[model samples]
Target chain A: MTQESAARRFVVAAIALAAAAAALVGLTLLAGASPIDALHALAEGSVGSRAALGETLARATALVLTAIAASLAFRAGVLNIGLEGQFLAGAVAAAAVGPLLSGAPFVARAGLLVASALAGALWVLPAAYLEARRGVPEVLSTILLNLIAAAAVSGLVRGALQDPRGDYPQSRALPDAVRLAPLVSGSRATAAIVAAIALALLVTLVVEATPLGLKLRATGLAPAAARAIGLPGARLRLLAFSASGALAGLAGGLEVLAVTGRLYDPFSAGAGYTGIAAALLGGSHPLAAAASAMLFAALGAGSSAMQRDTGVPGALATIVPGVLVLTVLAARARLTQKRA
Target chain B: MSGFFAIALLLAAPLLLAATGELLLERAGSIQIGLEGTMLIGAFTAFAAARSGAGPHAALLAAACAGLLAGAAFAAFAVAGRADPILVGTAWNLVAAGGTAFSYRLLAGATGSVLEVKALPPFAFGLPAAALAAFFVPAVLEVFLTRTRPGLALVAAGDNPLALEATGGSVVAVRTAASVAAGALGALGGALLVLTVSPTFVEGVTAGRGFLALALVVFARWKPLRLVPGALLVGGATALQYRLQAGGGTGIPYAVFLALPGLLALFALAAARGRGGAPKALGTPAP
Candidate 1:
């Protein structure tokens, strides 16, 4: 927390940014495009116009929520890597329930969102039980759960949750009456982003200012010491894990109501994993993680535009965050070694 | 029944190869959860090699080389650099996935046509030579881990690094070497897939097989030879799923078939109980 340390951290961030930028430039050149043009395209696509900004904000909604979810679990000493699966579970819940409700738009929307959150929480039960009872690492179990969820989604779209009126392998679409409306004319931005931001702030307040937050951090920081002091580490972990899942689930539900409108195979574009990367980049601080998520959303939005404008591939959006994270990790390790 | 067994063995070959390599790496005390990325790198390398006029065997060699570099790069960051392996791996997957997709676009252009590559020729029992050799990997690993001096040294590095250090060993060196070898094997597993069953490359051609291989290692309780049965079980399930799908209809939900392998792995994890014979120094940085 000292000024010197803060300055050192700034230097590390600068180096990492530089490294990522260098990688971006190299990739752009490899794609036979000028780096300047790519950069220009990226900027214009992400924030140059109202539509681009709207796209960025819309994407940020889910990323922000999932980042908070990842931060919550990580800070509570739980490695809940099933956010991807949990997200899918939430989306499925929304799709399954959204079509069944009628008459009142508000009630139907609320019902769908609640169902999604519950589904997300329920999805993690098996991993939690296996870890608590059988001493299986939640890491492996949660990853396996992700695979299962994906497989289930692929199946549901074709079989159980398929749209009866359509020939495609996808669930019934949510009626427009119940879906989220754009916040402004001619842009895709919706209330989902506002809700995501509010939730991020709330999580920050709970984790930083509350007694529960202190206990969660204490357990994560030192499980043995916390246990010796009767801190109920297991209960805290379970609470954190479930709450995290709920947040991710809510994100998924919002995505259905705000953007996609229906569930299908490959519903997520790795939103959960990218969210985890954002949390890591932010050092697991809820607000910082939200900011990182927004940045990633912008990168994703702009990369597609860049691809359209230039010949460069939009996969750069995925690669850049990874490069940044790896650089940060290596820098942190080097700093720790130096201090040692 | 014989046809089913043959298909199951064919499907098991890639999983067995990847799992064997992973077992060796974990035994040497470092874990690369990014084996999925390594496999992708290998798969892409083979695809590119084949597209650029290399023979199937040469493409395999190229992929193995790419795997070596991927392994070394991972070790540089996670091992020698002393970074958190898990975080490194999480990011590694993104980079590999994105990098391969980016490169594939460059190679294939904006064309939406399917690009096919030459498959490895079948040897015995309608299996490619590489696929047949995959079955022998676990046995070789079993002997290497139990009967050899270096193998014992690797175990020492995993279980008791300080003791190994006292006896003039370097944990970093052993882990790095194991990582490189593991990378080559994992890549070969991926290349074998493209060269045998799926003779064309696509985005994510391995389709979570890398992760399934990781589960297989856990199912095997970190024992090399035990990986065979675990891989076979998952492979058999996949074979069945394919057969069921080909038949056009089934009494059971097809989703159940898709999820069968993961479901089985979860049961295996829960049933096995407690750390399940994981290496003592697993996931720990070299002292």
Candidate 2:
């Protein structure tokens, strides 16, 4: 982190941003629309009005939490790619419990979110066990878990968690009495976004200022050296892994409480994966990753509007994040190589 | 029973092809965790080509070409550029998924309609020629790895890249070449899916087949010929699930069948005993 390297990093970020912007414009042109119209629509849709800003914040709630989840694990040297599975597990938990609870709204909400977080942590146990005991790569096992989770969701919607009152393959909806209310009238933004921001700040403080954070970073940065010093590498990894799962699970629970009232098959639009992209773009810093997630949320909100207004295709939301990450990865690698 | 076996083999075709390609790439010491993305790229290329009036075989060819390019691009980042393969692959999935979806909407014009392309002509037992040919790929790979000089060089590169370098060979070159070939095979695997049984393109049409193929390689313990039984097992399980779904009133839950392949793959990894036969230099940066 010398000044020169920091300057280089800034340059890399600038170039990557420029490239992403150019790609967006190119894609808009390819769709036979004027780039100016697409940009106008994108800005207007993401931040132009109250409703649009609300949409962006609502989307940011999940992305911010998941981004923090990814950053936490990555910072600890554990590649917990099963965030997607854990997220679904949490959503399923919320969907299952939200319908059955009867109590004060605050108590019910707390109970449901806790259950969802525990479910998400539980979902990752198999991957963790396989990796530690059988030497199986968590990468493969977690991905397999994702597939299993997706299958389970598809089945539960039809059988176990099915909304018996309706023919659709979806779980029973959460009662509005138990769900979070909008922060503003005519907008989707909720208290969940505020909670997400608070958590991000807390995690940043812990990682950047605490002794426990040093131990985790030490384990991640140098396993052998940490082992020589008698640090509990495995325990730290497990802690990070579980905590990461809990964060993602919380995201899923909030999605249900704040946005979608019910869990359906394929409920997520790859929120976990997009969150990982945000973390990568932010270089895995908690606060930076949260900012990146918010940026992505804006992109998603704006792109859908662009698609509606200028026929630019909403998939740009997915593509632009990917391109930025790829550019960042290549640039970082090249710079490191030159320094070495 | 015979009908079940026929359908099972047909279903196993794509997995077998993709797994074989993965085995080759891994054997060369570079793993593309983004094989799913590669397959999606292939599926879309075939669909787009066929929709644009190419015949089935020509579409397959187009898909293979796209895969070759995809493989080379991946090598540019993960091999030549020495970036983390796993991270590169994770991003690759996003790019491929979003790229195909964007292109599909552009091509289909937001109609959200079902546009079917012509399927390949059946070869035997109601299987396409490509599907039947997919079963023999493992044996071919086995022979290639054991008997061919280039294949041995590929293996050498994977097992001991420094030694290969001492002997005046470029690990990057061998890996890049292997990646290109693997890319073709993986794409063909995807094309066979659309041109044989499915005959249509959807977002994520390959589903988790790419992942299943990755599992198959690990289950096979990096052995070329061992992939057949594993692929057939998954295929049979899937076929049985379909049969059970069609014949309602079975007491077994439908989710179990849907999860059978992934569950089986997970079990295989757990049972495989600590990367016993994995390539020594698998996922290592090319020298």
Candidate 3:
């Protein structure tokens, strides 16, 4: 990238940060809280103490995994809006399978989690096939699929997977052995963050070093040229789609086993959309995507703290991300226009 | 019976109005994904206006203006600035959803219950009135699209902007106008929802109907003429699902029924085998 482009990106990032801060202020006022106090509480909640830092890291882990998933597909020119659905599918699948293997050892339980990831990847194959073979637009198809997935999962939880002890529509918690181990003592922050970071590095290496990665990026830049060079564009897209789904699935599985400890209706909480913003803000680079995810994670975790401490409604966090995405998209448009 | 037809007419009115506007916008080579947001803004504005002592017509007009401004602002970003229209539309939705809720809390003071607003009194021309409006509205829109001079220019802009530009028509102006009109019509749909269906404003009240209208436009292949049947088919399907749910039929999940329209569109396109040709320059910007 040229210095001009780098400078432009920095400007865009700065604008997004400023918009988020403004939104926070607006929301604080709307919620009848002091914006200054809310900001202080947000800062103190996110990084002021060790426990807060751990919570931030734990949230970042899930956000980063989903962000990486979104980054991979977006870099390859596919807009997989169904990541949220795929993430839910992965969580539900893991929740279903993890308890069934309670008699198995820890390694076996971990293997089941990996299998859940693959299951999530497999779930996206239909949409991928439709896009690659049938020329159906993935955006619309995936969005429709998301609605279907929500209803289907909700029904399953209500009908069969309902916990016997409670009427709440959710699956039973996973076995203790299947749960992810925490990285630090006295914190819920798990080894999943470490795994996500390693995966981000692996993604950076694959996209930069591997032949498949080169083909993927080539297809993303110019599909016609990639086709001319005999690059099997459809196959590559399918792989990217599945890999993206798998990463999203991994995030879901981690959330279920590590954070929520069970699968339930509305499992997503808009993580999929947040991941899209993270990937876009990060310019689809894996490491940058991780960093953006951390930013979002901090906002989410701190927003709750702000609400608790300063009486700001927690909706500010939700509102800020959408505004940030809009600002980033507009900035990107400006950049594209400048380049043209 | 008149009752069945009346109910059908009421159901079809909003869809027809919204789809008519969408048809115009799509014909100008710009799809507004923020129809839902535009409608929400309209609904909220209309309700607020009505609550603040404005007459029904005045409230409706205010809604239209709000929709027009919202649409124009979105077009400024997506069309003039060349942002991705989809993302811009989604942003509008996010803003509409959160903004409306925030504003509602501010105005209504967080009662944590459904709030009611005065509904527009329907213009009752008696027995023949509903039928006449339903048929006449779409018929007039169709004629305006195909027979008007600016309509031809708008279609030209969407179909082949370079050719139209060669002929000395401004594609951007036509598209912007169509976008504004589309926003107004979408807002009208929202106002109609408040007036006819629920008689109040609620969050996410449009309930994906705007998107369904978008799908209908594509299903109609940008033909205002074909849209009548397309709208009826969609409306009929929606009515059927509601009827089934009302009758307490549980064999098929309601979600499956809800997804039927999108699934049907995909299948129809697949069955058509890529032959339902879109405008040549649709979704491409004109220089």
- Model 1 residue A315 CA deviation in Å: 0.9
Candidate 2 vs candidate 3: the TM-score winner is 2
* Model 1 error, position A199 (Å): 0.7
Q: State residue A72's C-alpha deviation in candidate 1, in Å.
A: 0.5
lDDT of 1 by residue, A112-133 (tens): 9999899999988999998899
- Better model by lDDT: candidate 2 vs candidate 3: 2
> Worst lDDT window (10 residues) for model 2 chain B?
B248-257
lDDT of candidate 2 over A210-324, digit per residue (tens): 9988888888888899989999999999998899999999999999988998999888898988999998888888898999999999999999999999999899999999899
> Please, what is the TM-score per model?
0.98, 0.98, 0.88
Give the runs in model 2 whose Cα sits over 4 Å from its true position.
A1-5
RMSD of every candidate to native, in Å, equals 1.6, 1.5, 3.5
lDDT of 3 at A87: 83
TM-score of chain A of 2: 0.98
Predicted candidate 3 versus true structure: per-residue lDDT over A4-112, tens digit per residue: 3677888988998898778878788877888888899998888878778888888887789888888888777777877877887788787777777755556755866
Interface RMSDs of the predictions, in order, are: 1.0, 0.9, 3.0
RMSD of 1: 1.6
